[model samples]
Target: IYHVNNWYGVGVGSVVFYNDAIDANTDRSLYRKDHVYTTADKIRAGVALNNEFKFGLITAMVDWGVYLYNPARHYYDNPEHPIYGLGRRPLFYKNDGAGSDEAFHYIRFGMKTRIWDNLYFSASAKTHLHICEYVEFGLGYQIPFLKKENRKHGEKIFHHRKNWWQE
Candidate 1:
């Protein structure tokens, strides 16, 4: 991540494995597409871009991100195809290059808001081209694994009263 300023930053990354292992149902198998059911179920490397804006205790934050590749179980395209399991049908995840039906990439956008102190509530969506796969909600807690550095006291911005550290 490259911080554009005190409140903004940009990030890009390439990962050999980016599957949402956390989303997978441990009872199922990853090798079988029908068994695994997550928008990020693919086992391929991903290249992506993201940026964030933050201020103050960073409470109540809004965010957005762009991600390539779509996790396509293509269960809805045909009426005959059952929603669950491949049923002798081919798994649809790998991108088929540039084409309207199977587009190259998808977009991910979401927000995370602090509920109380270190606790947070998050909601996000995964859109494969124009198709929305799902909306996910989660709860998280920030563990202060590392002791915080002493913050510079009495910092003023735009002539406003000192803030962001007095808390």
Candidate 2:
């Protein structure tokens, strides 16, 4: 459970990329009768299935985790259709008061890799449990104190320093 607050706007969460399918989501029904569903018949009770193993592949390293403290909710126009009329759910930082257990427990899975020196390219899906809410892509720049000199295109020189840790 790593603490992170990325584009998801989460206050607290835990994430792990097992590098394979070994890591996945398993959430159970909230049972409160107030939850999100893909259908309206109430046939599909809930989507949050905890501790369940799911198989997946990687175009890049895979990440899976739970948003322990998520205030994000799914809004519906009605409750009598199989297709959730709503499109990709909208996310907002509503308030700082949603309970940890009562709030919607969202799941996030995605792929990310460093495209260049300190630039990262990432695309991930945000879901309640298994019900995917939306997918997001982002590029971030990381500030580095240790300036690693960019190598020349055709140079055979490789800088070998004794302990880069000590600057």
Candidate 3:
């Protein structure tokens, strides 16, 4: 995920934009369709609100994203269209090139906790509208030296502060 805001704090509003796509997966039995009645391969544009909740050393997050372009919903324009086959079913078209849909709202909420100062664990769940989509869990490791040489500089700063207080 790409973060537009540089600040990371509680009650701070972060605005972000995302473009998501569903790839064709034959193993998953998911396909991209281009027909009168088809599924949308793309959500086009997404806007989300990201908020952080802190609990001691652990941090939790809640995010809601609204998809602005859903091509799934269609209305019947010609029920007797030639391409509809023998049944003469209705011919559906794209709702809009880019438009908002109520059903495309997505939500994600999760927590991050430090397992060993630099090591961490994270868990999150994602849903489409109100339906459960998937849940994810991950393990991460961070080296203090990698974060702007925290190991060396951090020690010197602490040492200076300690000596300054004694003096």
lDDT per prediction?
0.47, 0.36, 0.47
Candidate 2 clashing pairs, residues 3+ apart or interchain = 1-14, 2-14, 26-49, 26-50, 27-48, 27-49, 27-50, 28-48, 28-49, 28-50
The lDDT, on a scale of 0 to 1, for candidate 1 is 0.47
TM-score of each: 0.45, 0.33, 0.43
lDDT of 3: 0.47
Query: Candidate 3, residues 1-167: lDDT per residue as tens digits?
Result: 22223224433233332223333332222222323332443433556677666565566878876655444222222334455432332222222122222244567889987666457788988765554556779898754433324333223212213333233
In order of listing, the candidates' clash counts read 0, 10, 0
Between which residue pairs do clashes occur in model 1? none
lDDT of 2 by residue, 1-167 (tens): 11122112122324422111111121433222354333232211123322211122112323334333222233232243344323332232222243222223455566765555456677877654455556779896756543444422222111133332333
User: How do the candidates rank by TM-score, highest first?
Assistant: 1, 3, 2
Q: After superposition, how far is residue 1 of candidate 1 from its true place, in Å?
A: 5.0
Q: CA lDDT of 92 in candidate 2?
A: 29
Worst 10 residues of 1 by lDDT: 152-161
Estimate, for each residue in 1-167, the C-alpha lDDT of model 1 and write its tens digit: 45566666567765343445423344333233334465555544456676555555342232233333334334223434354334333433443333323333456667766666457777767665656546878898866433333443322221123453354
Q: Which 10-residue window of candidate 3 scores lowest in summed lDDT? A: 153-162
Q: What is the C-alpha RMSD of each candidate to the true structure, in Å?
A: 9.2, 14.8, 10.5
